[model samples]
Target: MARLCLPDGAVRGIDIQGAQTGTVTSYTAGRDGTVTVDNPQHERALRQYGAFPANLGGRSTRGGYRCGVCGFAAYIKTCSRCGGTCEKES
Candidate 1:
């Protein structure tokens, strides 16, 4: 069981509350530095990493994203969505 961080919001960034146990349902990360957790309980821990609910409808930048803003290299090849844009995080 891994812990997930769920931060409501802040200036510096999100934070981790605690941990949980569950199989990862789904994940989404784009070129942006963020990660979304589909696991219900892990929501709190996910925030610590800097993930937030995106306007993309429960979508957030999946792991392995390359953030040009932060010079972060994305490991995952952009996700596929209907409008060509990754539906994970806008």
Candidate 2:
């Protein structure tokens, strides 16, 4: 007899946004309507984990933006890649 096992989590999507993707910048994740490329070891990490949303626009502020390891909650300056501002803008 053969047995089957399924992963509790699955990669959702992969999107290549921004002007120039030469060096990736600004990575974040949230519960709803949030986008992120989870895989760290792989270079082509455009996949996501959360369920895709219907009204991505209306979910403003309801969700949050955080670094791979909960960015805003902690004090993290200068993005790892381009050394940019990770703090939220007013």
Candidate 3:
């Protein structure tokens, strides 16, 4: 199982498959993990090299987002540490 750490610190397991025509990336969540990116550059890279590294989520860097309610800094898309939703500055 591959783990993807979202900006909100939410970790998701994903199943990645590669095909000759393109690559199929599947993430695991109730239903939210089913988005497909058809970037040819990413596709070519996947075909030539491989999937993301095992340590993709090893680091914990948080920036570019903050909790709207409490103004707390967030690493994940959602504010896991603060139990609030995080939003980017507009």
How far is 54's C-alpha from truth in model 3 (Å)? 30
lDDT of 3 by residue, 29-88 (tens): 335322233555443443333333223222323335667776655656687566888786
| lDDT accuracy of residue 46 in candidate 2 | 31
Number of the top lDDT candidate: 3
The whole-model C-alpha lDDT of candidate 1 against the native structure comes to 0.39
CA lDDT of 3 in candidate 3? 24
Clashes of 1: 17
State each model's CA lDDT, in order. Answer: 0.39, 0.34, 0.45
Q: What is residue 8's positional error in candidate 1, in angstroms?
A: 18
lDDT of 2 by residue, 49-83 (tens): 23332222323323333234333322345455444
User: Using TM-score as the measure, what is the rank order of every candidate, best first?
Assistant: 3, 1, 2
Q: Lowest lDDT 10-mer window, candidate 3?
A: 1-10
* Global lDDT of model 3: 0.45
How far out, in Å, is residue 88 in model 3?
1.5
Off by over 4 Å in 2: 1-75
- Native-vs-model 2 lDDT? 0.34
- Candidate 2 residue pairs in backbone clash: 14-46
Candidate 2 Cα deviation (angstroms), residue 27: 22
